[model samples]
Target chain A: MRNLLILIAKYGSTLLFLFLELVCFFLIINFNKSQGEIFLHSANLLSGKVNQQTQKISDFLRLEAENDSLLTENARLLETIINFRIHDQENNFEAFENKDSLAIYKFIPARICNKTTHLRNNYITLCSGKNDSIIEGMGVISNTGIVGIVNNVTDNYAQAITILHSQSRISAALKSSQYHGTLIWEGSEANKLSLITLPKYAEISVGDTIVTSGYSTVFPAGVPVGKVLNYSIDGGGDNYKVEVELFNNLNKLSYVYVINFPEKEEKEQVEISDGN
Target chain B: MGTKWIGLIIRLLIVVFLQVVICKRINLDYGILSFAHIFIYPVWIMIAPTKIPRPLLITIAFFIGLFVDMFYDSPGVHAAASVFSAYARSMILRFLEPDIGYDTDHPFNLNKVGILWFISYCGVFLLAHLFFYYSVEAFSFVFFYEIIMSTIISLLFSVFIMLIFILLSNPKY
Candidate 1:
């Protein structure tokens, strides 16, 4: 105890200096707005760099699995192209009937740099941004299901608001019944979403598949979303509220595709004029 | 000894007033570029009597910086920088110790120390204080370019003003 006291006496000033500096930093971050944001942003950027390095090693190990998924996706794309060509020949006989249905969507591949699934409003950061032609409001999807919508973009990074967010509402429909509804998150489960506005009369079962309705210019039609888990009628009794189990495991996502629609501006303009 | 303490307190009050009231208003702007800020408040910490206990000196430095921060609308940035410089003061003193060594009885002043030693001593502490102040204000090393630019420009102006103040006052604590 005597030696301990001597050490304290010798180093008390240094200890006090460090403690007070810590207090100052705490106060600085808590009290100031811009400083706090800068601190958090820098911290995120630093962590992103570290995550990128680790992801590279893990990605190398999972190359075979990743190649298999890519091969499957390529085969699906080839089938889609062949089907489109067949439809084009049929369209020649029925020209101008399906001109608007031919909305072209380009897919840009990106790797997830950072993501959060547990937050009330979770966000995913992509490694590709303006350089890769990504912009705000673009739909992001995995091979399994829908992922998110691009919220903001920087030079080399883009932030996306996932379907797990409270404010996220995507236009979805039942594959069998063809009834449309709004997919929303209830801020609890990460993998479950609520599909509202579906009419009670629509034939819905537990195993019915849900897919994007393509009402908006963000996503193309018939993209896989989830499967209906269960459903209930609200107090109004006019609509069915469905609980959907997402196809993609958001927690294990690594790669995603951002859909770039060329006709988005034209569609938006037409809608704005129709609104007037 | 008691009179010396009173004199020191009075000097501190005057320095704080000059910093908050006068120096704060002097904007160094050239068209669109406003590069420099006059930070004469650190002069008090730079010239404080070496005989004072280190912990007490650092604590006093914190409150003085907090007081200045109140006027600047920054909560703890100045206080942090002040504490850092005050804590670093002893090491600087030890590094610059002459063959005869420092007379801890008197505060550092142009009248007590020669021009070369005084300038070097104040210059080192002022650099530490300003760099730390800017770093805490920015709160990120990502704006390292802006931090370095502001530090160099502000350091030049602050040192010039400090030399003029010391020459005129010729203070001896």
Candidate 2:
């Protein structure tokens, strides 16, 4: 018993060290599964914030290059969308192209340099001009819907009259019944335009989609105009004045495409002497 | 005797602070070595009075390493490393002892030993400590290459830092 006591006294601290290490191993193995995750997350949060602060320096240096890449990516996506539309039309027998007819519409991509939606005669200036084959009477549209018709052109830039202009008129129709009408904007509202000349017999309802009629050589047919919000009939009760919510918001304009209908000029030249 | 313990406690606090606060945040990753961790806390156990009981020294080493593990967010690894180091310390001390041997209450310190002898003593212990630390941290033999590289690189840095601390403070424990 005395020898055992002496040994206990001699090796007590070593036992304690072994015991504490066992506890540490227990904590490391067990808590590491659950609490350790939270602990590491909090620690990483501290270090992550420090990294973010330092990363800001490198991020600022790469900002211009990043912006250039993002813009190029956006352009590529837009081009892909245009190609998909062309492919879709090729497969669609009803909307199939006729090479002998007028001319195929080619989209010329352009960025909006300036726009004014508050004015009675709102105009949108595009980056593309006469140099890019953009001419007066060419129609402009965005990813959303029809935007405006080309009104003037310079060597480097072109100005188009927006759909919100009071004088600007577009031929559109009810998608379901094919009842055609003229889309005109009142001077008061920017986004809300009225579809006039829609026959009363036409199947018109709230939320009915209005699309360009393809009757005019400017705007293509089936370009989404907007949904029907409300409509009224005149005293004659023959035509509908449809309050339409436009898809293209001029205030949010960025990139736009000018659609060139090649047959327009030749057909118009054969009829009238207007070179547009 | 009590003053010796007081000095030890003070050194413990300073070493722990240096380990947890300052050394923890150093962005030391370079080359194939993942971390250049400089552990100065093991020096607290290394330079204790040669006459102290081996078990007591080992226990203290365990606690010091456990304390560091709490802050490092990796429990058990430092404790395992420190305890191993402390156990190995007794053998190394016995091997490196002078013919005259050590006197009770007279601890090894920079003032007591020649600089070259002290540096070699610190280098051997720190290398072992760092090797065990990285080995336990990796927790797998798959990181054999990593463990060796980290241990070698960290040993160089840790020993240099330990030497600098000894040279500057030159603590008498």
Candidate 3:
């Protein structure tokens, strides 16, 4: 009894240090996707309002550039309108309507509040939540390409685990061959992530476009992920680990969109059953 | 002694305020040296009364760090740094046992310990503190060169400023 007591006393601080370290590790390991949902969502709403207010100021300051973009878009649209009238009764009209719907799905705007890119596990907050009809597992995007997925939601705010996070895994495919694989963050750089598990038989090339596979219901089909930067065959030459340079610069992220799939729950259920 | 405590509290409040409000605004992002933030809160850890109980000292250190973390938007870096400093302090005190005494009844003084002993005391622990703090932040040795460079620069700057505070104070003890 005395020896046991002495031993415990002897190693108390060491034990404490180990315990604290374990606590920190546990916090790191179990940094849940759900706990941050409320704070991030609220922050998103507040930041969204703030961003909207500041945008007016920025718009006023950059009126010339804004006008230039508007003018260019106006010119393009005017040309399209003229072309449309010229081809009013033509075959391309059907094609144009289809393209319009595709372009319409390109944006699902949200406001950012609490965002961090430097950490191993990075996350972003947005101002669209459950009440906004935002749901967990919705695809998030920007003007460029896929940014993240809606991980959780509160009444008025939503949080996204960005592609930069080590915990993030997305289904991706080669734009050319439609070969699908897993995409993961390398944790070395903010801008780069990796697409893994491509079969050696699949033809891949440098600068080949990578996009969301639409394999998972989170992101819709054919959203641009990045261009293939580098790749190498595994030791057995069975698969390729390819580097993907993300289109949405994780560092310069500001506004994003939460893509709401109306049939998400049903789709996920189907996927789960199929997996089983 | 009462006046000293009041002065210390006032200085601590100012340090915390400036660290959050002003130092954060100074955005100096050189490769490894954000010179502005290098020693912002370490000053508090350096000046805390040595006589305070170890666990309480560590708790205060942890909260002070957490407070800095809240403002800086970093979750745990400062808290971890401060706690480690508190943990290692007694060992540092053991190593740098002053020949006479630390004037416990009065207040801490640099002159009493002399410049060399003071420097030795701060130098050893400050380096250890910085090493652990930076390692936790970097989280890996891949940025080994960068971490070392930052550590050296930050430690030097922090120690310099710490000495300045100590010398300027000219404590009666």
User: Which candidate's lDDT is highest?
Assistant: 1
lDDT, each prediction: 0.85, 0.79, 0.71
- Give the CAPRI rating of model 3: incorrect
Worst 10 residues of 3 chain B by lDDT: B31-40
lDDT of 2 by residue, A1-276 (tens): 999889889877667667766776667665555445545666698999999988998899998687546654654444344434445645543332333231356667788899999988999999889999999999888778889999999999999999988788999988888899999989778889999988888888999999888778787677788999999995578988999998878798787878877788677776666543
lDDT tens readout by residue for model 3, A74-169: 434433433344344655754544454323222345667778999998889987688767777777877577788888899889999998888888
- What docking grade does candidate 2 earn? incorrect
DockQ of every candidate structure: 0.52, 0.20, 0.04
User: Which regions of candidate 1 fall more than 4 Å away from where they truly are?
Assistant: A48-276, B31-33, B107-109
State the lDDT of candidate 2 residue by residue for B95-171, as single tens digits: 77766775444547555656777878888888888887886676555679888888888888888888888777677
Q: For candidate 1, lDDT tens digit of each residue in B1-173?
A: 78888988987898899999998898867842366888888888888887788999989999999899899888889999999999999898888887877666664756567888988887888889999999999887888988888888888888888888777766676
Estimate, for each residue in B1-173, the C-alpha lDDT of model 3 and write its tens digit.
78967876777787788678875676668755663345656666666776666666666777777788687655566667677877788778777777675667543566466678777777877887788767666655666876777678877776876777666654442
The share of true interface contacts that also appear in candidate 2 amounts to 0.45
TM-score of every candidate relative to the true structure: 0.51, 0.50, 0.41
lDDT of 3: 0.71
TM-score, candidate 1, chain B alone? 0.93
